[model samples]
Target: MSYQLQDLLYLMQRLRSPEGGCPWDRAQNFASIVPHTLEEVYEVVDAIEREDWGHLKGELGDLFFQVIFYAQLAQEEGRFDFHDILDALVVKLLRRHPHVFPNAELYQSLEAAPPVSMEEVGQLWEAIKHTERAEEAPHQPTRHLADIPTSLPGLTRARKLQKRAAQVGFDWPDPSGVLDKIEEEIQELRAAIASGRQAEIQDEMGDLLFAQVNLCRHLKVDPEQALRSTNRKFERRFDFIEQQVQSAGGDWTRFSLQALDAWWRAAKEQEKKHE
Candidate 1:
């Protein structure tokens, strides 16, 4: 396993070599590789979602290559190398998993203790993370809402931001409260529409969406994943509508709203029949 990984690292180094490396590979900069890295990550997730082990192996290799690409770029700039990255990761893992490490302060008790619930493990993990954060930057100001990446998808970021706030007790007491907030936001959105102010409508729309994220958080659902699942369902249903329209000798653009509605209902009925 170590030999194979070392060979892959050597291959990456050769590809980035200025003398006779692949032109396109050598041309890539950190910024230029971001899109490919993101796409590869999504491909890996897609493989796991589909439970395609063979495809997953390939996708994971692609994802790993993204890490290698970044590490190579950093090495060229005299920042760090692949081993440095691995060292940091290993150090972090050992630091975080005190219960599993022999030299850990609580190792004896953790090893001798009876089985614990996953919730207990999670609380311990969070506590360790808090300690690590404080130790890593002792001079930095303590921040409850530590900087979450703005590059995250809006729904996912909102969930994370809300979760951070919830850690400090700034959240709805229950999912029922979140549902009520959603209803309130809906009314505000309707009023915005009635007022016919574009800015108000946009602001209200944002509020409604934010409320929806809060409800998802309270219900322990990932809003981004939920949205993606709905997107796939819509695609499937729309494809069924298109197939039906074509079977009936019609273009979708030429179909009436009533006709489309009928097709949509039929598609839904087909789904129920399958279920």
Candidate 2:
């Protein structure tokens, strides 16, 4: 018989049980499992980006297991469990999609619901999210940027911060303005390098990267994905250079810069041919 979500939940419970439980699973806490959850997330992303459909199912299963593990931990602590998680998620989605669920009822017929423009839907989603954020912190002032997680990757976090600020009219008017800001940041970085103070240089470098992320946002590009693509390209070209060196029976130290440059040019040509 095919196993279902209930079976998966049972498996997690067994693994975390004190008696006859997997030692590694039993030892893990919320904080200890965070790294594995992050790795699983990236693996899922990698599989999708590579279009590895055969492995995508397995990667997604691994990511889902991380969620199950977290729920198991919370269940043991007398907190919410997997069912609660599902309930909250479904409720949130129904609440957010007012256009589809006009009566705010999940089981209600959608036949009579009015169609919504994509632009209006986007605005409505943001407005709902802002209201939810305010409700979450009713006693205190609502800081627009307060809810963004600090644990996000630098480029991803920078893009989110920029988007939040833009909602409040605190953003560059156009991509050209962002380009000018990037150029200004680069000049500041150059001056910092000339000063030779480590702290100043580091700060300037951060400013330069933040400006680049802003430029990417203004250009409708994902800075993280763009950098990942470049990284893969670099790896492919370097691998070609290594293969060329091995074919020539030459050591890396013996190869001059000019030889490596020629190999790099050859790699570019090969990539163009494939394209």
Candidate 3:
């Protein structure tokens, strides 16, 4: 028999029940579950990047369970429940996609509404979000950077902050300008290293990374995704190196730096041939 979402919610409730609940589940709180939620999110992203369709469903279910867990906790506190989460999500999505739901009505037919270009859709989405933000805090001053969560991964958050600033004409005019900024940051980083001040080195390092993220943004590339791809490539090349070492009697002492360099080049050539 096929189980439904209600079944999953029931299971969560059982796990968190005071009477006979799993101790681990009962012990967890919003703060404690955050790490697990982030891990599950990365797992979903990894599965998609690997094109692991067979396991994607399981990863998605794990991510969805995170939401259910949060909802259960909120429900227990009498704040809100899973149904409320769904209602808010549906309402927000319908509000955002005005092209699809012309009257902001979920059940409205789309036959009469004219199609919108992708660029126009993006503009409309941002405009609607801006209006929503204003309505959410009518008295508070609008701060574009304030809404971005500091908990976001550094590279992702940097890109978002840059994009937000760009909307107000506060960004590099082109990728070339970003490249120059990155070069300038690199020079400052080198100077900091020469000075041998740990604090200055760390500060310059962060600036260098932030500048690189800006370069990625100006080039229309996602810095996080680009780094992930490079990480995978590094793994593949290192695996090749390990295989070579194992073949050579598993003796790292026998191979020189030159030999390892040769193996790395060979790995690159092998990848090129596959491509």
Candidate 4:
């Protein structure tokens, strides 16, 4: 580590110390820090999406500090510390990227392998991950579905599950097939709604979302990114509607659905014009 990073580590240790440390910093535990860590990750993603490089730098620092916080807590608990985290990452990186790190023991036999495309590199990465998971639980059978973290966002987890199944030739042939399945899922959801059984409806709704995520994967679109873009567009258009309603001397509820629809259309038109 650089001197600056070592200095930061020392600061973290001091802040987490029982004596003369900030009370809030000294009190946090792993579970308590999780929400802040997740928030920092989302903030970093937001900065990147907005193309705000200056804000991104700060967000990245915040995200890195979350790692440091976790490491500090682990050290207090007699678990691994920050250096162990870095060492494990180094090991994993060298083990996974055989094409780049052929001198490593994991890739010594593959040193003569042919040049690989990016797609092949991705396959190699997945294979290495699978091997690592198997090594982690040699007594139990490895299941790709079980390898995906439940903590991931719903859409991301859905995509990963679909991709893992697709690797074993379980996916639809193409986007058209996925679209057909999506329509079928919609019909099932409608049926569940008509049945008026809440549990059935929930199950069908989940299936619909999973099918939609499959369609997104087939179309080469990230469902999370696509939804976020749509969310931003909705917020922008709704803000325009609010402005128009105020100009007309009315509140949102005072405007009829037809009036709101007209405003929405106008907002969309204005957006198109700006584009």
Q: What Cα-based lDDT does every candidate model obtain? A: 0.86, 0.93, 0.93, 0.91
| Clash pairs detected, candidate 2 | none
In Å, residue 180's CA in model 1 sits off its true spot by: 0.6
**Which regions of candidate 1 fall more than 4 Å away from where they truly are?**
1-3, 102-112
Clash count for each candidate, listed in order shown: 0, 0, 0, 0
Residue 69 Cα positional deviation in candidate 2, in Å, after optimal superposition: 0.5
Model 4: per-residue Cα lDDT at residue 86: 94
Point out the higher-scoring one by lDDT: 1 or 4: 4
lDDT string, candidate 1, 1-275, tens digits: 35588898889999999888999999999999999998998888778866899899889989999998899899999999999999888777777766577464432454565566887777777777777778778999867567678888889889988988887789999999999988999999999999999999999999999999999988889897788778878999999988888898867678889989898899889999999
Q: How far does residue 104 in candidate 4 sit from its true spot (Å)?
A: 2.0
What are the root-mean-square deviations of the candidates from the true structure over C-alphas?
A: 2.6, 1.1, 1.2, 2.9
Candidate 1: the clashing residue pairs are none
| Per-candidate TM-score against the hidden true structure | 0.91, 0.97, 0.96, 0.93
Tens digit of per-residue lDDT, candidate 2, span 1-275:
99999999999999988899999999999999999999999999999989999999999999999999999999999999999999999999989998888677889764965778997998899899999998988999989899899999999999999999998999999999988888998899999999999999999999999999999999989999999999999999999999999988858988999999899999999999999
TM-score of 4: 0.93
Q: Which stretch of 10 consecutive residues in model 4 shows the poorest summed lDDT?
A: 103-112
lDDT string for model 3 (105-189, tens) is 8876548678689889988887888888888899998787878899999999999999989988999899899888889999999
Cα lDDT of model 2 overall?
A: 0.93
